[model samples]
Target: MIIITKNAKKYFNYLLNKKKIGTQIYLFINNPGTQFAECGISYYNNKQFSNDNIRIKYDNLFIYINKNHIIYFKNSKIDVIKNELELQLILKVPNAKKKIIKKNKILKNKIINVLNNIINPQLKQHNGYVFLIDITTNKDIILEFKGNCNGCSMSNITLKEIIEKKIKKLFPEINNVLDFRYYKKK
Candidate 1:
């Protein structure tokens, strides 16, 4: 239930008419590890639509949002504020703060359990182990490889093809499994 305030709706319609563009609008949570989750709007050209997204028609505009983010987006209200010279769109998301903290705890524990039970055991055979450094807001796993895995030639392949696949199979929310060693070498 995303509510576009009257002022914001009028402004949005004006911008669309003035530009004469036929692109759809996408509202999503951009969690780039900046300590706060931001509401981001994108002008989508339909080139990168996903089946996991929820499509909504509001007035003369179409909004696409990820299904996973719907919980935080519920009852969100968008309003246009004009201060002397510039106009800004302000989103009032009441439940987002609470949900963010709760979800992270749940996701982190689940990832840690998977790493201990499944992924680490396999790598242990090679006299290597991976430590979970952090989980990004985008659900990407950031791991630090230790022992033989730290500088192994097959680390990249192992992280992507094997570790990532296993984690993703268990938790669909998990994105990329990033090894810190690879980036440090680059």
Candidate 2:
């Protein structure tokens, strides 16, 4: 069953209308995972090693799910929640009681502070700044490159070979690093 939030009706209707004849919108609950959606974009969710929340927004419509409730759905259920929230069907599968690791916010903050104080200052000459975007329990770090580094050809190399290497030396727990940068036209 799929649940559609009250605000999602118009958007859902628009999607349905856009579909050709019998073509159906594939809606599935991402148990043991999460989905991220951006404004004016199609909705997507994936179930992977971590059970993340589902998020989406269209016009005034929004949809979200709590991480804790992901385990209960054995199958997919799509319906509207209280005629207000639009939700999708929850997919049922064998419960994989994998250990859920909460993110280490304290460490994340420390890392961010270090980047601001140490990393950014070092890159100041290049009109670049290193920003900490997110940290996951899998010891993965997400960073954003801004200013001159945004469109630089060597940004990826700098992120992996320079920034990430230094960070790993300081925080051994960080096993993976990702660059999440978007260029802003000046």
Candidate 1 runs further than 4 Å off: 32-35, 100-186
What is the per-residue lDDT of model 2 for residues 1-186, given as tens digits with 9 covering 90 to 100? 234444446546666577544332323333343333111123432322224554444444444444454443334333333335655432333333333343486788789888988889978889988788778667788888888988789888888888889899999989977876532221
Clashing pairs in 1: none
What is each predicted model's overall lDDT from 0 to 1? 0.80, 0.59
**Tens-digit per-residue lDDT, 83-169, candidate 1:** 999898887776565434567878888888988999899999999999888888778888988988988999889888989998899
Model 2 residue runs over 4 Å out of place are 1-103, 181-186
Number of clashes recorded per candidate: 0, 31
Error of 1 at 77 (Å): 0.7
RMSD of each: 8.9, 12.5
Error of 2 at 143 (Å): 0.5
Model 1 scores worst on lDDT over the 10 consecutive residues at 93-102
